[model samples]
Target: MSASISVIIPIYNGEQDLPGLIETLRSQTYPASCVEYLLVDNNSRDRTAEMLIAASEEMATQGITLRPLTEANIQSSYAARNTGIRAANSEILVFTDADCRPQPDWLTLLIEPFAKENIGLVAGEVVALPSQNLLEKYADCKDVLSQKHTINHPFCAYGQTANLAVRRQAFEQVGLFRPYLTTGGDADMCWRILQGTDWEIEFVPRAIVRHRHRATLEELRSQWKRYGCSNRYLHELHGVDLQRELKGKESLRRLARWVLKELPINTLKVATGKGSAVELLQTPLDLFSFNARTIGQREAKLPEKAKEIDRL
Candidate 1:
C-alpha cells in the first residue's frame, strides 16, 4: 500500500522520552501500516542515538520501521523538521516532536480533514503537561491549550509544529520553512501560505498530543526571551511594524492576565470582543518589554539561542 502519511519526528537529545513517543504511535487507532515513522537525529551528545537504535530493533520485529537520519551542526528544531520533510516519502507529511505523545486516534483525526482537495495544511492543538510549578502554571494560565481549532475560519492556519500535518504540494508551494528562523518557524509557514494562494487550512481538535514544558522558572524566562527574539525576527522578516501593531494587539489579554494573577485591571467601560481591542491596548507594554529583553542584540540572540539548544 502507498504510505498515507510520513510521521516526521525531529530530535536532538530526546533520550528516554523518544521511546514513549514511538510506543504511543504504535498504539494509535490509525492502522500502523498507514504511516512510516521517520526520526531525524541532529547530532546528539547524549544517549538519544543509542536509545533510538534499541527502539528500532524492537520495532523491526513488529514489521514497523523507525528510520534515523543523523547529521552535524544541529541548528534548531525548525532545521531538524526541514530535514525530516526532505527525507519524507509520503505525500501527506506530519510533523511532531519526540517529546510529545499522540492520542490513539491522533494520526487518523489529523488526516481526515484532508479529504477535501484544497485543504493544504492541517493544524491541531498542543496539550501541556499539568504541573504544580510556577512556570508550568504560568504557561497553563497564559496558553489556553484546551482551546480547539475553530473550524469556521476557512483560513484557519495557526499551527504549533508539535502537531501539524501538511500536503507535500502545499508545503512545496509555500516554500517550506525559513531556515533563518530558530523559533516561530511554524507561524512563519502559516503566514506564507495565507499570503495569497488557492489553499485551505483546517483545524482538527481530535488530532491532539501532549507537549512537555519547561520545568523551572529559569527555563521559562529563557523560553520567553527566545519567544521575544522570535517575535522580533518575524516582525522584521515579514515587514510588519510591530511597534505600531503590538499595542493594538495585546492590552486586554494583558489585562486578563493581570486578572488571572489577581492583579488590578487597568481600564473600565469594558467592551466585549469580536476584535483585537484589548490586545491593542495591552500590546504596547508587551512590546516595550519584549524590546528591552531582545535588546540591541537581536542579531546576537540567534547565536546565543543556538547555544541554549540542548534539546532533551
Candidate 2:
C-alpha cells in the first residue's frame, strides 16, 4: 500500500539520539507499510550517515522503507526539510526533530485532524523529556517550546516544526520553509500559511512528542544566541524592528535588576528550601537568553548597517 503520511527528520551529528528515534518509529501504532520515513543528513560530520545506512537495512527487514538523503550544499535544517518535502510521496507531510521521541499514537493523532477540510496545519504538543540536570530541569519548568501558549496569541501564533504537520498542497502554496534562515523558519512558514491562504492551523494536544532540552549552560547559551540571530533575520524578512523589540535601555536595566537583586534573592530562597529551585534558576536563564539574543541580533545586522552607512 502507498504511504498516506511521510515523516521527515533533518539530522546533523544526531548519532546519540538516532537509535531511540528509530526504535520509536519502528514501534509506531500507525501501519508500517503506510508510513514513509525520510531522514535527511545535512552533511553530518559524525557517524550519522553510517548509522542511517545500518538503520535502512534493519528497517527494510521489517517491511519498512527508510530513505536516507543528503542535503550537503546547504547547512540549514530548513533547507534539509525542504529537500525532504520535495522528495516526499505522501499527501500529508509530518515534521519532527532528530532528538524527539514520538509516542506510538503520535502519527495517528497528527493525521486525524486533517480530516477537517479547513485545517491546513496541525501543531502537536511537545513535552520536555526527563531532566538530568539543573539546566534541563529549568527548561522543563519554563516550557518555553510548548505550542499551547502560542494559540490565539496576536503577535505570535505558530507551531514548532519539531512536532508539526502540514498538508502537501498548503505547504507548496506557502513556498515551503525559507532556506536562508538558521532558525525561526518554522514560525515563518506557519505565519505565511495563515496570512497568505484561507487555511487555519490547529493545535492538537493529543499528538505529543518528548523532546530533549539543552543539558548544560553552554548548550543553552548557544541555543539562545542562534535564536537571537534568527529572530533578527525573521524581523528583517517581515519588516519589523528588531532593536525596538529586543534592545532598549529600560530592558537592559530590568534585566540587570533581575540578575543582580532578584536572582540572588530567589536563589537564596531556593537554597533554603523555601522556594522552587526550577523557578529561581529560570530567572537567570531568561536574562541570559535576552542578552544573548540582543547580542546576536546586533551582530547579524552589522553588514546591513554597514551598507546603510555607505549609502549615507
Candidate 3:
C-alpha cells in the first residue's frame, strides 16, 4: 500500500539554508501528489518566514504543496513540531531540520519501512556535510547522530529529529511532544513510543540527510550546553538518577586532566604534524562539552535548590 507523507520542518533563523533545503525537497523521488511540505516558523527575527512564504508560492506553481505555519507563542522547536503534527494531513509525519538537505530518494526510502504492519517510526541516518575546517571534521567523525547505536540500546534509543518519521497513529497513541522541552524532545518521543506501546521503530540507513555541523568552537560548546540543559529536564521528568549518569566529580576530573595534560600534548603533536588533526581538535572539544554539559545540568537543578532553601 502506498502511504501519503507530510514532511514537517521547524525553522528559526534559517533563511540562508532554507532555499537549499527546499530545492532538495523538490527533487525528491516521491510523487508530488502523495507528499506535503509543512514549514513551521518559530518566531524568527530573521527573514525565515518571508523566505518560506516566497518558496511556497513558487512551489505551488509547480504543483507541489508547501504550507507555512507559525508557532509564535512558544520558542521551542518541539512546540513548532507539535503544531505541524496537528496540521499535517497525511498518515506519516516525517521530520527533518531546515538546515538538513535530504537526498533525492530520502523520502522514498524513509517511508518504505512503513509498509510493515508493526512499524510505527522510522529513524533515518544523518551524515555530516563535507568538512571545510578542523571543527567540522571533528564533528564529522563523532558518534553524535548514530541512530543505530541508540536503537540497539533501547533504554537510551533516540532518533535525532533531523531525520526521523513517525506514524500518525503512533503519535496519537503516545501523545504529542512535550511542549515545555526545547531539546531532547525527539528522544523523549522515541522512549514513549517504545515503552508505551508495542510499536517498533526501524532504522533506515539508506534514508539519508546531510546535516551541517557547528563550524566553530563556540557554536559547538553552545550546542552541548543545550543538550546538557535538556538532560537535566529529562532526568526530572523521568525520575532518572542524575548523580548516577552525570558522575559530576568524574567529569570534572576528566576535564582537568584534558585541560592540563592531554590538551597541551595534543597541541604540541599537532604543531609538529605528528598528531592527527581530528584527534587534537576533538580532545579539547570533548572536554569542553563535558564541562559545559555538567554546568548546564547544575544550572537546571538550581530551581530545586531554591525550593529546598524556601522549605528550610
Q: What is candidate 3's lDDT per residue for 152-243, written digit by digit as tens?
A: 75255667888999988988787888765666678778888888898888999999999878888788888877767767866766654553
TM-score of 1: 0.75
Overall lDDT per candidate, in order of appearance: 0.67, 0.82, 0.81
Q: For candidate 2, write residues 1-312 as lDDT tens digits.
A: 433999999999999989999999998898988999999999999999999999999999999989998999878898899889989999899999999999999998888878889999999999988876888888777776687866654555788889999988887676878665677678778888888898888899989999888987888888877777766776776654564444567667877888888888988898899887676766557777777777777777523421110000
Q: For model 1, how does the per-residue alpha-carbon lDDT over 1-312 read when each residue is reduced to its tens digit? A: 433789888888788687688889778777767678888887787998888888888887887767777645555676677777888878998988888888888888889888888888888778887676544555565563443532332333467778888888877776667654677677677767767578777888767898767766456556656656665665655654332233434656665665664232324323334333333344333444354445432542444343221111
What lDDT is reached at residue 55 by model 1?
82
For model 2, the run of ten residues with the poorest summed lDDT: 303-312
Lowest lDDT block of 10, candidate 3: 303-312
Tell how far residue 264 is off in model 2, in angstroms: 7.4
- The positional error of residue 307 in candidate 1, measured at the CA in angstroms, is 20
Candidate 1 minimal-lDDT segment of 10 residues: 303-312
- Model 2, 11: alpha-carbon shift in Å? 0.9
Q: Indicate which candidate wins on lDDT.
A: 2
TM-score to true structure, per model: 0.75, 0.87, 0.87
Off by over 4 Å in 2: 1-3, 241-272, 302-312
